[model samples]
Target: MKIAVLVYGSPTASSAAATAYRYARAAIGLGHQITRVFFYGEGVHGASALAAPPQDEVNWGQRWQQLAQEHEIEMIVCIAAALRRGVLNQQEAQRHGKSAANLAAGFELSGLGQLADAALNSDRLITFGG
Candidate 1:
């Protein structure tokens, strides 16, 4: 199966984002193809390179980045939601005259069109949290 995933909550605030990660990893382990993962709302925080978790806790952004890199999965963050939450890529930060960018590696900042396309192209679209 070709699957697309939507993550809608913050990993720091709740377990929903972690659950989504586990689901995607398990699905891929079972031989399912994950076409993309679309991060919206607080879920966009999962792609923040600036997040600093404690040594005892999992670094959600790094986990997601590694997964995307190893599996060749498309990881996308909603640009509007990200901007509203202050998660900016290098280009976006430059365009907005910010001194720094915090978007993590292995993730792309895009709009809702990418989510729409993922929904249309994948055999299944699963959403975690909201």
Candidate 2:
């Protein structure tokens, strides 16, 4: 099955992202194909490069990056939502005169069309949010 996981919360504080991560892992373990992981709303913070958690804490950003890498998952963040929340890519940051762009390594800044496409192509679209 092709699964699209939608996350719309902060990485550290929000259980939505964490729950989506777990679902993705479980799905992958069950031999399911992940269509994509889409981030929106405050969830754009999940892609922030400036996030640095202490060694005692779990780095949700890094965890998501690793999940994407291991499972070959396509990580996508909504461009509008990201920009609204100050989550910029290198190009967007430069275009907006920002000092740095985080948006995570495995994540791509994308538009709503991507989500629409994923929804159409995916066998299931599961949303994780408050």
| Local distance difference test values of all predictions, in order | 0.93, 0.88
Off by over 4 Å in 2: none
Cα lDDT of candidate 1 equals 0.93
Q: lDDT by residue for model 2 over 5-123, one digit each (tens)?
A: 89987776668878888899899999999979999888889888888888898777788899899888899999999998899999999999999887778899999898899899999
CA displacement after TM-score superposition, residue 37 of candidate 1 (Å):
0.5
TM-score of 1: 0.97
Tens-digit lDDT track of model 1 for 1-130 = 9999999988788787899999999999999999999999999988899899889988988988889889999999999999999999999999999999999989899999999999999999999887
* Number of clashes found in candidate 2: 1
Best by TM-score: 1
Pairs that collide in candidate 2 are 49-102
TM-scores, one per candidate:
0.97, 0.94
* Residue 55 displacement (Å), model 1: 0.8
